[model samples]
Target: MAYAMLEKFEKYWGDYSTLLAIVIVLDPRYMMVLVRLAFSKLSIPVEVEASIKEIYDTLVKMYKF
Candidate 1:
């Protein structure tokens, strides 16, 4: 039961992490802080940094649009 729940969590997290990060950043209270913190916890630091930059740039383009 517990294992199944954890499996579901991992599956959804992997599938929707980018969307979740984008949505969270739309909130002023969180912005990038929470997303950066969460991404920092991931295994790859280099990718984390790149992803952060990409997400920020995407947000900028969104605002400009």
Candidate 2:
């Protein structure tokens, strides 16, 4: 019973792990470098890629006067 509960907890955590990581790594000092490094470590999961790409695109548009 304990093992089953732990497994479910892990599954739930894994689902949002990348989003949590991105929120942490998003800082002016590190900028995109740490974000890229984190994604590389995660082997570039598709959902993470989409999230990062959205942020990148938004930044590009913002800077493109």
Candidate 3:
């Protein structure tokens, strides 16, 4: 049971749901810090910088549209 829960957690941590991330970033209290913290918690190291940059770019694109 513990293993199953851990596996589920790892999967969730490793993947970023774009819309959810965007919403989180929009909040001043959290912003990118929360995203960075989430990725940091994952067992596997993810390229967080690029992902964050992409998110920023996406946000700008969305605003400009």
The lDDT for every candidate, in the order shown, is 0.79, 0.63, 0.79
The C-alpha TM-scores of every prediction are 0.67, 0.42, 0.69
- Which numbered prediction scores highest in TM-score against the true structure? 3
- Candidate 1 lDDT (Cα, whole model)? 0.79
Ordered by TM-score, highest first, the candidates read 3, 1, 2
Q: Which one wins by TM-score: 2 or 3?
A: 3
Instruction: Write one digit per residue (lDDT tens) for candidate 1, span 1-65.
Output: 99999788777654336667889999999989988888777536897788898888888888899
Candidate scoring better on TM-score of 1 and 2: 1
Q: Report the lDDT tens digits of candidate 2 across residue range 1-65.
A: 99999788767654444445445556667776777666555545786687678667766665695
lDDT of 3 by residue, 1-65 (tens): 99999888878666777788899999999998998787666524557767777788899999999
Winner on lDDT (1 vs 3) = 3
Shift in Å, residue 34, candidate 1: 0.6
- Candidate 1: regions farther than 4 A off: 1-16
